[model samples]
Target: RLLTKMFSNHLQKKLTTLSTLTDLTISLDGWTDNSGNSLYSFMALKENQEIVLDILDLLADHHTGNFLKDKLKEVLSINGIKILSIIACVTDNPSNIAKVCMGVSVYEQGFRYCLSLSETARPKYPEIENITIKNIISDRYHFANNDALTKVIKPIVDAIGRLESNDSTLADIFKELINIHQQISQLEVPINGLKAHALAIISKRAREFDSDIFFIALFLSPPHKFLAISRKMSGDKIIRASLELAKTWNFKKIDTSLLFKDLLSYKNNDPPFDTPFKSSSQSLRSYWSEFTGNAPLLHRFAMKVLVIVLHGASCERLFSSLGLIKSKIRNRLTPDNLSILGQLRNELKKTVHIKENSNKTVTEFSTYNKARPTGF
Candidate 1:
């Protein structure tokens, strides 16, 4: 009981700190354990800063959307967060969670198929052409009668520039921009011809830019993160196509600066950085190794990694710990007790690792009786 109370207090403090921070991205994953525990984890990063993992919940059976929604609400309630600060949700590209229908599927299918198929059979996708009409829905981008494609592209162009930075590569920024384009393009109804114009614009920008430093810097970061984004977004298709296109364009080799010698040595020695391994499974490990074993392996490697990113693997690990902590005597655990156990497991895991320059402290100090020491 005392251990449980202490854990609850620690969790309250952690949530309070996170709530005060601005801008957070949330990622979640579901898992099943050997003991048949169905678990979910929630992870948050404040504006690309500190990481917070909340074990969120564990269940006896499989998870569902309503369960997840309630878990999210529970976190919000505990932290006293009234509104979401930022909303970047990262989930696997193959997640069936997002594809589930919330309403009557029959009605929705009938509405979209009935009239639309008749129009589409004539090769007239009202859905596709509606894009142009939607653009005219507002004359905001129009001067006189002609639509200004330049005006439509400026914001997207600027976003690409910000995303470009020294920290990202042509491959990185290009993939992101193309994803934005794909999303706009994939909208059920073409709100405007804006998407068609946007893709052309991004493609032009990618080809014309001459920035080698940015690409090199991007490659320096561990390739694992690239896999996470690509896997979650299905943005690998965009990257694969971009890299192929890049081969045809001539650009100056990115300078390696002072570490040129070291970089070259690394290139010669290490088995070139392959795509990140997604799991301990033998098939995925073999698949990644063979798929990424090549020069200019960046695009292929990223594709393999993104196919298997998981946000909540660690949290699910804690639920395993919970079973151990609860034991058979405590099998019928209360929600409050389980929550505390999860928090304690997470907090204890956060202790920093000591390395080469480990801090040294004297465990024992020499003590002297002043008069006796003087006489001696």
Candidate 2:
């Protein structure tokens, strides 16, 4: 118990530092453990790093949207994370989780807009698109159309897969959706029939998982700054959305007027932004880092938006470790003990090194040499 307290304190300090360093995307999902306890895991992700935030044993509490929302608030408050520091909240079950996003205060307005946008973006009966394709395949008694459909659906599936990556950002997701729309639009008539249907579904699903934050992130990303124009999304609209998001994030020190001007300069490819980058593969973080002196406020804001992780896969991934730790033989482990063990396992994976020699792997605690506390 003493060691568990020490480790818990160490992990809490690390989470506090993470909250201060960058904006986080809170990814959450629920599952049942071997002991029949209903567990919901919360993970905080930014850029390429993921921190396990908490695992709640819901016990007999109903998992309704309102109930989950209060629990989410409790977790954030305990971890010292401010509501404004969250870039997005992602989960697999959108129908229920949507309430969690929309029941909050000012942020609820953005989510409300998302729901409205999704409704307006599609026809009332969008499933007819899929039914049309199926009828064609059945009536014609041919499989060629099936192959063509695969080409269209494969890209969309791959794009969704990319979201599960730890490094995926909001801009990456936006770009993928746009690319899928374009790819579908370019297909010939019968295949193109899927265009309106595909686009409507994409817009609806995208908005369900995202909000104006996505557009702002796309505008901030260096390579994608001009891509939105191709989709008829006006620069002014994106700028206004960016400003609104900044306000919601409680960035009081930002000079909106100067930030607007800097946005124009980047959009127009003026001055510093005009100079071609030395490498086409420059990362978003590194690209934004270079502009801190020239566009301080914009740089600060961009860094926050660009670091957001787009999916709840990290939270899901943690469940595998949780399952192993709480196997049938270990079903009696308390939730506190489970959480401590899980965090220690994660931390050790980072600080320990494994070397292979003569068909044997040696485990070495590298942090011991650096005099870092390992909570032993």
Candidate 3:
């Protein structure tokens, strides 16, 4: 009991610190555990790190849009996080979650359909009439269509995976969306039939990309600036969006003329931008850090926008961890205790590494003291 109290206090302190950050992206997901408990996980992502905020057990509560929205507000309020600090909220493509972020910037995961046409759309041969199943399987046209569909869907699945990575940025997502559109639009034959259908879906889902914030993120990305230009995204539009976002953050005294000049120089690959990085694998944030003195405004803006988390994988990961921690044998654990234990496990994962050598498990700590909060 004493240990649980200590951990809970530490987590509260972390939450207090988290509330002070600006332009944070919140990721949410929900799932049911083996013991019939409905659980919802919330996480906050800033820069490259993700902080597991809380997990709620919604006992006897209806999972409606308004209910979920109120619960989310309660969580944010308890943690001292202001709505203004949240740049975006990411979740799966569910109507309730969409409604929760009605007035706020939200990004829903793209449509996911099973690519295996036969397995997904049809039943087993034994289950259906043998003759009918045989005829469907023997159709050459069906095979051709399935092959074409796979070609289109495979790239989208790969793009989704890239976007879900911890290091992925809004710029990366914008580039992927553009690449998907181009790949379909520039096909050898003009759009028709399956291609046209796929293109339409992409267009519908790409509506979120119409927001200038996404374009601004792409514009500020050093490696992707040329890609944005080639895609015909307007520089003037990006500038307007940047200024608008800056004003929201209360940067009223910013030099608009200097920002414009710096953007032009950046786009043109002038002196400071011309130099190659010391390492090819340098991160976008690190790359932007080098030019802070020359492009102070852009650098400050890039640091805020470039780190937006593009997926809800963090919440999904928390659910997975919770499942293991709250197994059948431990099914009786209370919600408060479960949350504390789950958090401790997550913290340990960062500092503890176990290696097996000579049939023995050896545990190593990168920063033992840092892993445990004060007084633990």
Q: What's the TM-score of every candidate structure? A: 0.34, 0.69, 0.70
- Residue-level lDDT tens digits of model 1 in 1-376: 7896776677677777776764355567665444445556665643223244555447753367786777777866666655435334444333223212222233544644644664567665434356665464334423322223333444455554454232332245544655656654554433356567656766775555334322332333344224323332333333333343333232123312212333342333455543344654433234333544444334333332222222333333555677676676766765555656666666665543222223332222222343345646
Residue range with the least summed lDDT across 10 consecutive positions in model 1: 250-259
Each model's C-alpha lDDT?
A: 0.46, 0.70, 0.71
Top candidate by TM-score:
3
Worst 10 residues of 3 by lDDT: 103-112
- Rank candidates, TM-score, best first: 3, 2, 1
At residue 245, give the lDDT of candidate 3: 78
CA shift at 303, candidate 2, in angstroms?
0.9
Candidate 3 residue lDDT tens string, 59-165: 68999989988888988887778898887888866432322222211121111122234345675322334667556555645455545555666557767778888
Candidate 3 backbone collisions, by pair: none
